[model samples]
Target chain A: MADQKEEVKLLGIWASPFSRRIEMALKLKGIPYDYVEEILEHKSPLLLALNPIHKKVPVLVHNGKTVVESQVILEYIDETWKHNPILPQDPYERSKARFFAKLVDEQIIGVGFGAMAKADEKGREVLAEQTRELLMYLEKELVGKDFFGGKSVGFLDLVAGSMIPFCLERGWEGLGLEVVTEEKFPEYMRWVKNLEKVEFVKDCIPPREKHVEHMNYMVERIRSS
Target chain B: MADQKEEVKLLGIWASPFSRRIEMALKLKGIPYDYVEEILEHKSPLLLALNPIHKKVPVLVHNGKTVVESQVILEYIDETWKHNPILPQDPYERSKARFFAKLVDEQIIGVGFGAMAKADEKGREVLAEQTRELLMYLEKELVGKDFFGGKSVGFLDLVAGSMIPFCLERGWEGLGLEVVTEEKFPEYMRWVKNLEKVEFVKDCIPPREKHVEHMNYMVERIRSS
Candidate 1:
């Protein structure tokens, strides 16, 4: 039920989990939008102008109004679109979803990079333990729930799901660690398998080999410097 | 318009800006809530149980459901109490407000801590410059608007306003830096002035002398360590 004047455009990089979350949200809501892939190394002038503060993507330009920060954009998407809701209708549930999404962003994805950046295996192991500890919380959160959003994939699923390929798979692979083993995070692994069953979610993830290669290159760069 | 079954309780500390934001949001919405003052140094068992994830204050227990994180709690408050909306009506404006609130948290309050913790003036000056650069963005956002929320104190105001005493005044005073001077950031200064005039906002802020003393103690601890 988008208006004729409702033009939606997303400036994103395909490999970025942040940008992918936006794509998944837009697709999940059945919102039609143009995708402009940004070369983050040499960002476009439009990208700079739209998100002058962060100078990053995915920048959702809705009717020329720019929305940056992926989680904030997710909320905007849910509010703007009535169909296929992303966040739970209940405020408490929505807060929990938001809280987990943030935990994934800050604790999992944020710390995953640190684990990958470790110059030595011992250092990597330490960070990996920290990641596993954080993942245990999510595992506990997943009990009797198929997704963080429950029943069907929603806000937190998109957020944590976007990181599955890049962060969990490639991130652990590139770092030569197994922080998310099925033994340790059985429920979390089940949650991941459930997410994989979603076609739209699968489409949002980058190719594993290509993502692993990129993550390895980045990890090497981080370790070296 | 609160229900009879609705019971709102807040676990917070007087000196914590994070905790104060929740208090302000509750007061702003005219939603009556029990204020359980938490001793952070020796956090109570209930506080630990309520927010086991962060084990932190500013946890909102509403009808036995807990919502942590000050920004998330602010959103929860706005949604639960529809009257005197803390966030804007339009999706785009709400997104902008959330973005700035986040900016204030991560950049201003977060980095402001770094600026204060610097053992040397040169280090503090460097971080103070970074803080100033970030504040300038808020300053620019404040132009032509009475508050970041526009015409009234809203989400961003509560987020930024909570930090006024702890981050800007006591924070700067403790560190011996003047990053948010009236001359340097005229619009932001005006916004602060406007917030001070609001009675509820003033009540949320801690006593200046006590707060400054506490902040200086924190600064010294950080520096020495």
Candidate 2:
């Protein structure tokens, strides 16, 4: 149901997990919106104007006002529309979902990207530690649940699982880390499969080889310089 | 209104900025909640049980169920009890507010703490850069507005303003940073003063000396080791 009162537009970067989260949320809500793919390296002046502070993307522009940040966009979407609620009805359940979602934002998204972006031995070490910690926490938390939010794919699942294939392709799996081993994180692995199967997610994800090559190049550049 | 059906208990540490956001939200909502002071360093089993992954405060336990993360807790409170709503009525405004709030959480909270926690010169440099970026954004965005949400304090105000006095007291001002100078961030400074005057906020905030001492110790520890 596209409302005539306001036009919905999304300013995003293709490979950004943050952008991916907003895209999935919008799609799941069945909200039709225009998408503007921003070249993050050479950011658009419009993107800068919309998000001057962070200058990062997945910005959702509705009726001219721009909303930056993925989780916030998710909340805005949930509140704006009633259909296909991403958050849980139960307050506590909603909080837990949001907490884990924040965890993914802080730990996984932050460190995972940091690891790929930095090539220095010290930075890599820090990234490795952070990554290991995040995976360990994920392994423990996702033990029984099919997704982080339980049976149905909810906010936590969408936010946390969005980064999985990207992280795997970025050599997170090849980092000699045991955080997501089959024996330890069986449910997490299953959740990864489930996330990969989602149509919108499948369609939206960038090629793994490109991401890997970019990450490797970045890492090498950091290490050498 | 303390309804038996909606029993609310807040598990929090006295000095945590994150926990203070929830406390402010609950107070602003006029919702009477049972306050449980949690020792974060030696987390109680109950805290672990409530939030196994993060094992942190403030955890809002409602009717035997728990909600963690301050931002999520604010949303839950707003949803559960619609009185004095923390978010905006307009969808676009709500999204903008939430986006800025998330920015405060991600950039300010993360990088601010990093500055205080790290001892190395390089770490401090990184922290300085991030802090400057966040503050500069805040300064520009907050121009002419009494609060981020405008007119009256809202979710963004509570979340963003919570850090000000703490940061100021913990050597942010002493560091002679250009980002949050009085000339640059007049609105932010005014907002900080207003927040400090609030009874609930005044009661909840830790003493300046304690914060300064703790931060100094952390910095020294990081440097020495």
Candidate 3:
């Protein structure tokens, strides 16, 4: 990374947890980056050239090398900027962190968001049951831990924590489908509060009112369509 | 890894690409591991305990430390073993490998498999087109490469190559849907042949006749139910 003239740029969209993951990682690492807000409907030529495969936002270009995929980007950032140490040093612990983060990403984006987007009433019930089970699993994983990284905000905190605000906005408030409550998942709730207090993440995330407004619009569009 | 006494064990099921991935990686690294085949219908308690979240196979237990998820396991193996060096040394190159491997994993398992599993005649046509497009995208990525890893059979090759034989046996020969033929994807077809030639992979994969029989059974079961 030192050999080349260093220039870090992150192309991302607001209200996208995936994009926000990269944004938060950059902030956590104390890495200064140029944030390019791309319109999802009309992607920039630079994004198309950099990430021809996905053509999506949250493309990190460091020293002119492009890295797509949020989790992959997070890994790249952690590897490049070794100051914060979001991922664990031990191979076993790192693997576990990756596993849980993958679970949360796939569950929220693939199953929960997907079912919420296109499901009918019966489908919503099934989605609700599945979401509850997923949250419970995460709840168990977070027991006796202040963060997924344990006493510090780490990789899972950056990845999973980025999605929590959206869940709060869309699932809890907008759609009234509560998955994480203090009663059920006290640990996960605490993790969310811990993430919110982190100076880097606080700056990276949008305010609650803005998130609710955006998520409400998304919910309406997805439901109507 | 050398300093400590190593006890590597892998829990996997035969006729599964994900399982085969770990098998191939262990072999490529020349790591001796006890392979325990678990019946999917009745998952072993050890399997459940090791990977409580997914409860799936291809779990690698190294010195009593458990690692689940095939890609994460591959990374852990590379990190721990460090002899074969499956993942690239450069941060950018490593990120790219993770990105493409993830794309192939998600696309094949998520889109192609899902559509192929549940689609009708008309639906099959659309799914076939989608599959072809996905393959074309991959083919484009493999323009001048001998393998996805370029010089040697690396991470993407191991993860992706494991899934191709099943595609041939299940999707093409068994079901008459050929998304990857020599005419269309010579590089990919060549990759399939090349992966078959690797000593570890050759020893690990099920025989052609056996694969055909198993895939036929899967096709029947999936189609029926």
Candidate 4:
């Protein structure tokens, strides 16, 4: 209301699942905006200025105000756009969606991400067991629903995707770990296929080839370092 | 609407900051509800059924539906009961509040919690340095405002209070750690006093003697284990 012309700009780098989360939100909401692809190693002045606290992308600069953290940015987008809603209407239901999204980031799959990156052979085996246990826990939740959101991709889907898109693309496959196979997790497999068909998701997600390459490099870097 | 008698319930453990966060929200919103005191080691059947995934405390059950995660529950309470808003009105302003809350949970105070819990002498020294650095950063944000929310106790204040309340009660002082000291963090001290004066917070927070006893026991258990 204060600014005559509103501008929505995203500061992020390609291959970052966090940044991609917000990009998916914008695309899903059908909002037009400028995107500043920042070099993570060399943090941009704008990125530093906007999100001095975190100084990480994907910071959503809306009408000169900054919203950091992909999850926070997603909420801001949903609130501002008010169309094709990401979270449910009921407070109770909204909490469930937020929980799944929160789960993905905090403990559900995050532990697996780090353990896989650094664990030795025996450690990796233990991690694989734990990850599968967690995946099954999530799969049990999707027993009857078409999506985590039910009938459409919702907030939880985005949150889960943000945590493991890179891993889903190739890292898991390369590591010989299975999470969403139709054989093991029929509902989860179906949900993945359903997400792949969504136009917004297709537009926002990086290509499999580039994502795999970048992810592999990152994994190798982390492992070696 | 569907259920003429909509029952609100909270499943939580006493002395848990997460649980207390929800209690504060309920008290602030002035909503009457049933409080289910759960044994952390041995969770209740209702707790397991309601929050099958996490099974953690501060699960708000409304009209048979469930909401887990303290932050998510806070949002739900604010939305469901419109009075005494936890978050600000404007979307940009809401984002800022959420950022501070997120920061308190994720990074700023999380590091401090871990450091105080397990760090050795050298590590504690490094942690103290980082903690002071972060406190100074937050202090800069509070150059003009009375609270993180500015004037009234708000979401970020609740979040920060959730973090250091254990320390706020002389628990950390018993451990020879000074976090919210008047000398070290002058503005933070004022904010702590302001929060303590709030009726809702006073009603919900555990008394100093009990909290300190529980905390010291926890600290010893952690050290032994």
Candidate 5:
């Protein structure tokens, strides 16, 4: 347990998978933190001050020290809290976990956003094709494992699970395409199914209807722009 | 020391700062390894087999286990060797180190590439301006610290030192514009000068003339295209 006097707070937008990644990590470790949801359109001064470099959400303040970047924050959480270890203990295994986490961030989340943001069908198709091609890497990674973390949710799972099965689930709908399906990504889908069963995993995920509504709202703006 | 029986090999291109980052980490840890210079245009079959995901260089093969990605490889080296520590032992300080390292990669390395790849003057100007704005963050970061790691060349130094001072030093000349300078980035330049005196860092950096020739060749191809 953390010192009772330690102050833990998270500044994040409710709909962001990035924010949810931190929430999941904090929840998984049972670290108590005060949540401050930022308005994306008009970010709070505190958020900007805390993360002036990016000025984006998902900033973790532990005893007044701020850590930005979702992956960096995840590592911070793992290192700060010892129980319910998110990352592997072995160095080699930790490297593998970090590699996949990076792959998911770049290929899945980054490209997945590109796939969603394209206002044109041709543009969306090209990116969706690229996203699918990238999905194969993740699928191959999951060939024999129940989760990216195996057995239970680990660092990669928190990174991948938060984005793919959560954000991309609604995002694919915005593109009028099913980016991830059992037929194409059986192992990935199986991993998603396994994540869905985890109670805390389910808890951290935003409500589907509200999420879909918010995603659609953003997609509409992108389409109009 | 790593087991004497273990085979350590690094597949890397001589001109690559990414590869050099790995090399510097290994040298700092005093780990002995055979280096295989990879032809980037026609990557070795062994390289492909080892890192099929990216099929890129700086692939570390330690006793048959392959670790790709420079940052991941650095962590692996630090953890596996447990000597001449690169990353800080404290989690918070480590997080700060990681944040700056990431800024260097994205803003300096990635954007610097984009700036260099722009064939047209306007395109280069726009990107150069963006890159400069980003460098201010690094300038602020180096306010009170001698190195990003503070004092000795640590993890962030290995990352930033490998790329900015080494790769970008000659790269600025290719564009006939200096992206980083003593006036604009006083502390960063001081850090660069400090790194220049570090014998191991100097050892990892490719000879200037060769790096310039290779960079110019690539730039010429980019311009013609």
Candidate 6:
């Protein structure tokens, strides 16, 4: 256990919200870990070996054992560390938090990427509709609460908040869609602003232009094709 | 707590894999609760009141408090109960399990439903391709393991396996596609067979004819539209 504490390392990409999820979780838990930024385009042998199935970022290596996937990593961090608990101790609340987190990951993240990569008007419309539906759900469910779980930041906030700036930079701003406007989604806007103040999150997020350029390139590719 | 446990009840639709995910988790945890099957086509007033946003099936009520979403309900059940734990204690393993489970839920389930709801060549091809990808990842990651977490049927297995019969019925037989052939996905097939044999699962899962009929109707509607 003593040796385990000293060997925590995170393999991630600079601009990835998924990677930031693990990063924020570790920071929130006050665990010290070595951060390794992987060049996702180049594909590192170590990254491939660590996450053969997905070969994606945000792989946590502890005592030589590796765990991939950001949502999974958040849970692992909460379970591994007892202090500064990110997940609620009560089962029902924990479930609600996780389910909301999964909703963000599955519906919001999935549809956001789909919208970014889509070229056709119909495809874009489908993605937009899905995104709107998600936003509406969030607006209704998360109203009057500072975080999804209320008061202090918890797992859902960490996962959902980490993606906001990136999604705004990439999906919403890049596509010129007013999916999450201040007028329509005041609560989400408040939540996003609150998340930006967190120290680790401020430090770990990628430069806004990088995400914009990347998304612009994708949109251009879709248009040309 | 005892009074709270007594008031717990599950509002579910029998054919839904999502509902089954909750049922299986509760059964595994040895929790005693009343189960009410909701008719989804004409959603009961109770169901609508419990889950106004999605108005979806598999809503769990504990002491008159409702928790919607099957994955959310599963986590709630696991946390509420002490015996027969479904999720791993270690953070890393839990994350890996969750990531895979989410992948299954979002990708596999999404594609599976798509396959069922369309009769066109493009739809079938997309479904086949996605199913193959999901099975490939599962086979590679879950090789030699009895369940996703090695020996016991944890959260991953419950979430992933909940959809097997639906896939086999709609994906394999109804679509006339060999999505999980014996040679291509031997391990997945074996796992599905093993999961089906569980006593609670066997009792809870609806007969194949019902799912096939619903899927065929969906396909007709999609094609006509």
Question: TM-score: which candidate is best?
Answer: 1
lDDT of 2 by residue, B31-103 (tens): 8889989884699998999887678898998787778778888888887888787888887778777777777
What's each prediction's TM-score?
0.96, 0.81, 0.92, 0.91, 0.95, 0.83
Pairs in clash, predicted candidate 3: none
Interface RMSD of each: 0.7, 1.6, 0.8, 0.9, 0.6, 1.9
Residue-level lDDT tens digits of model 6 in A1-225 = 124447999998876788877888887777888999898569789899988777889888887878877877777777777788888777777877776777787678777767766777678778877787887777776788877757777898788777765544465676676566788888877877777777876766677877777768766775577
DockQ measured for candidate 3: 0.88
lDDT assessment of candidate 4 = 0.76
Give the candidates in order of lDDT, highest first.
5, 1, 3, 4, 6, 2
Instruction: Name the candidate that leads on lDDT.
Output: 5
Better of 1 and 6 by DockQ: 1
What lDDT tens digits, residue by residue, belong to model 1 across residues A1-225?
A: 566668999999988999999998988888888999999689999999999888999899898788999999999999999788999999888888888888888778767788888888898889888888887887888899998888998998898888854456687886568878878788988998888888888888888888888888878777788
Deviation in Å, model 1, residue B199 alpha carbon: 1.4
TM-score of chain A of each: 0.95, 0.85, 0.90, 0.90, 0.94, 0.89
Per-residue lDDT tens digits of candidate 3, residues A13-87? 987888888888887777778899998678889889988777887898888788889999999988888887889
Q: Which should have the higher lDDT, number 1 or number 6?
A: 1
Better of 1 and 3 by TM-score: 1
DockQ of 5: 0.88
Per-residue lDDT tens digits for candidate 4, residues A1-225, read 113367989999887878887888788777787899999689988889988777888888787787888888888988888888888888777877877777777775565665558547677667666676777767876888877878887788887765665444366655655545578878777777778788887776787777767766777877888
lDDT of 4 by residue, B115-135 (tens): 566647677557666777777
| Candidate 2 residue B197 C-alpha distance from true site, Å | 3.5
Q: Could you list the CA RMSD of all candidates, in the order they appear? A: 1.6, 4.2, 2.6, 2.8, 1.8, 3.9
For each candidate, report its DockQ versus the true two-chain complex.
0.91, 0.68, 0.88, 0.82, 0.88, 0.61
Residue ranges of candidate 6 with Cα displaced over 4 Å: A1-5, A110-133, A136-146, A149-151, A169-186, A209-214, A221-225, B1-5, B111-133, B136-146, B149-152, B181-186, B209-211, B218-225
RMSD of 6: 3.9
Can you tell me which runs of candidate 4 are displaced by over 4 Å? A1-4, A118-122, A143-145, A165-169, B1-5, B118-122, B166-169
lDDT of 5 by residue, B80-172 (tens): 999789999999999988988888876677678778888888888788888889878777878888877777789988887788778876776
